[model samples]
Target: MRRPSLLALTLLFGTSIGLAQTTVETIAEGLEHPWALAFLPDGEALVTERPGRLLRVDPQTGGRTVISGTPSVDDRGQGGLLDIELHPEFADNRLVYLTWAGECDGGNATHLGRGRLDGDRLADFETLFVAEPCVRSMKHYGSRIVFDRDGYLFMTTGDRGERDRAQDLADHNGSVLRLHDDGSIPADNPFMERSDVQPAIFSFGHRNPQGAAIHPDTGALWIHEHGPRGGDEINRPRPGANFGWPETTYGREYWGPEIGPDTLAGTIPPIHHWTPSIAPSGMAFYTGSAFPDWHGDLFIGALAGVHLAHLRLNDGHVIDEERLLTDRGRRIRAVETGPDGGIHLLTDHVNGELLRLAPAAR
Candidate 1:
């Protein structure tokens, strides 16, 4: 189970070598914007295609079977079937949580649902949470699901392109929200007593946070969010913390205009920042025995850059970065350590491939 360090892999092969240490094989093809992936108890994977199809992907054999009864998805720009996560007690409860953009009363809304995984199909799906009062814009529906150690569900939602709404507690936009397993707000939330900020708001001022996970050693919530043009950030979330968005950033407007002053003192600094925008998506900390030396390293999937970025940290500061999959030229969407200790990836492309990364056989 003891595998080689990424530093060792790099030193051994150097830049002249491609990602042969990581082998990518097509597990399924013809997927329309495959966004998220989750493992089943049976060793297969459930993949969510952005156009609203869910497939049970068999990693071992590269077989795919479409799961039935998926809810209708609003496939607008950057909106559709999004992140999927399994219930904490999935082995016994068989529950799954999903995020998608769905049509509400008269407009579009972000919907979170739960269902039972039943033999390659989703059954008894019920709406667990819905971003209230649907927004008109179909963009920026930042939806990712995470569960706290205590089993509370933490859902991150975007401001739906309405920047002002992020400051409005009544609106679900641009906020990290916490809810009970069945979708009720925990009274202990920072804003539970305030009527303006909804009881669910865990933190505010996030712009399109797509990657979220718990740090293995610290157990703190960590998030990766897309900045306007150049500044993509890796942030550690905390209660009542304001992560300055429109007000501050190292990025500029997409139109090539300056956003705000760069050296603002009050704005929270990113633990790590990527200039020129890698368009980061999938993020997870490496803890498996496959790479014992990389136990606390952070693995990030880069879409625009079409690479897998490894951030090596020492005492919480990023000291080095290594880019893999440059030769493959595929948008890496999700990166996770597999049950077998190999790094598994669900790529994003016309023909996305599932990849496994380890040290090249000794």
Candidate 2:
């Protein structure tokens, strides 16, 4: 269904106005809790379902092919197959990377792996990295994989519901890690020289970060994490920086007690934050040409808010915000910029759908 232009809506309802006349189209439907989307070299795309399935979908026809040789996932509450990314040299290496919750010693932990795409199967799939000191909780398995411009792979991990773990540099929980492409610790990592800290850790003290993206112009890694009662945050993690979670949060506990002060002496504050908790999921920077007026804007999927957040940025800072697709009330699980400059979104539901947003026909 085509949505009325933001300009028209503003004129009719006295709401905020936008530049482009937008159209929302359903590209595919009947997907099972689709979590992430990545466009292949060709026009087709790869989609991951929370229940451990990978599908190759044609945007034009909605035809799907179930990819084989995927790793076994825990498939428990908030734990399953998650983010997927193509190798920077995918045209040459045919490698695809994925993150999921897998069975570990104590319980399940987020794992990273990759394999070559050989026809409809993943050939020689291998597990690369697994979060340490696995716990029994089914929540907070943060696992978003992003490759930076320098070809270094970055991964996010949650505190596994163990609030104290965020402050522990010895553990991988509640941290952003940087590593070589082959899952080896990078020599230049902030913690590499310190034997007391995990060598892969780039930054620590995060909650449960689910959204990550590299800035289109600056190439900095930006992430968004969920908070308890409020205080969802968007942060640009720096090397060895501490982002105070339990020790310094704007969110109150579920039981109505304050977690901590909003800012601490040494902790880095978030660039932007949400008070009512949007429960953000996927994120992407708009560099596509289809929406010229939207260039450089950031798009994020909101699970709790059930809308797509359109954030206008100025010089790396969020200047304005607009909520898109609010009428649908679909829990948007992922957001991606299509090769054609359209916006692609994955809805979270038993019978999920892949929707595309583009400039409306004049």
Candidate 3:
């Protein structure tokens, strides 16, 4: 009567995943450590390279044009240019939002910025959010952005390799933050009235959350964070709740010592956790008609497992799971559902690629 780990699940069901008849094609190639992508209204996409380049990729010709005005990034270990997202009213405003690791006092910190798309350059650029009290570490800068129905933006920040920082109210690390479109902290944020807390903090005690998405029907926020050695988590964090990480984890250290007590008081448990760590990255909810049976399912890209995971859900609970693209053996860094009922994937590497998955028979 116990749940199995991701390794067990992969071994049990990896070979049995029967995917739909799909054709895989490399749409764009030669990207350097690509991290995230955002689709434009004109059938093109803006792709981010970890070395701080932003390229506008043409869907048809597989061509790329480097967009000007991309901010300088640290580009160190697990750092660099990251998630990109377009405004909900992008068609009218032509605004794009970006998150990356920027140089701080003596280290790098996650920074979110917004700019207007004007020809091949980003004009009127402005910094939206930047983590505070940056420490000198090369890892764990959690960065992802998702917008809600009301257009408010939510973002994730990691513990910056400091476990105890997660439990601190003043540290921007290890927390989910909410802000208005123009970088102003939301007045209604849970901790806004608390003098000891950051007004932008929505939730705290998170580790390195790599992916975030808004539920289609429920409008709730869901995020996936990496664990130390195992125990990766997918949590639906409510406002002001604590998601236990170093304080309490189901994971063990890389050298085999147990983490914390594995259960901390007043912490909300993950809805689903992968014990053997899938290294889950970008995720999307399939609402497209191209895959009828897959509609309403959640798809997450895996880095360590090197597969695309599909989790079937009913009323927010995962009922079934499947893994695809295991043979390719590439680290999938980002995944998104296209407007044309197809799936777009970005492989992470020095020679990364933008891939498309479509119905083969179509």
Question: How do the residues 1-362 of candidate 2 rate in per-residue lDDT, one tens digit apiece?
Answer: 22232122211111134355677778788999898989997968999999999999988777899999999999889988999999999999999999999998969888999999999999999999988978898889889989999999999999989988889999899999998888999898998888899899999999999999999899999999998899999999999999999899889998898989999999999999998888999999998998776777899999999989989899878998878888889999898999978889999999999888877677
Residue-level lDDT for 77 in candidate 3:
95
Q: Per-residue CA lDDT of candidate 3, range 228-345, in tens? A: 8898889997889999877888889999999887677889888888879889999888777887767778889999999988888888898778788787898999989887788889
Give the alpha carbon lDDT tens digit for every residue of 1-362 in model 1.
22232122222323323433433444555666788888887777888888898888776666789988788899988888988999889999988889999988877888899888888678999988998769888887878888878888888887787777766667778888888988888989888777777778888877778888888887888888887788888888777677777677778888999887654665577888888999889888887897676787888999898988988888778888888768767898887777766677878865666666765555
TM-score of each: 0.91, 0.95, 0.94
- TM-score quality measure for candidate 1: 0.91
| All candidates in order of TM-score, best leading | 2, 3, 1
lDDT of each: 0.79, 0.89, 0.86
The pairs that clash in candidate 1 are 158-174, 159-174, 169-197, 169-198
User: Which should have the higher lDDT, number 1 or number 2?
Assistant: 2
What is the Cα-based TM-score of model 3? Answer: 0.94
- Sorting all predicted structures by lDDT, with the top scorer first, yields 2, 3, 1
RMSD of 2: 3.3
Please list the residue runs of candidate 2 whose C-alpha ends up more than 4 Å from where it truly belongs after superposition: 1-19
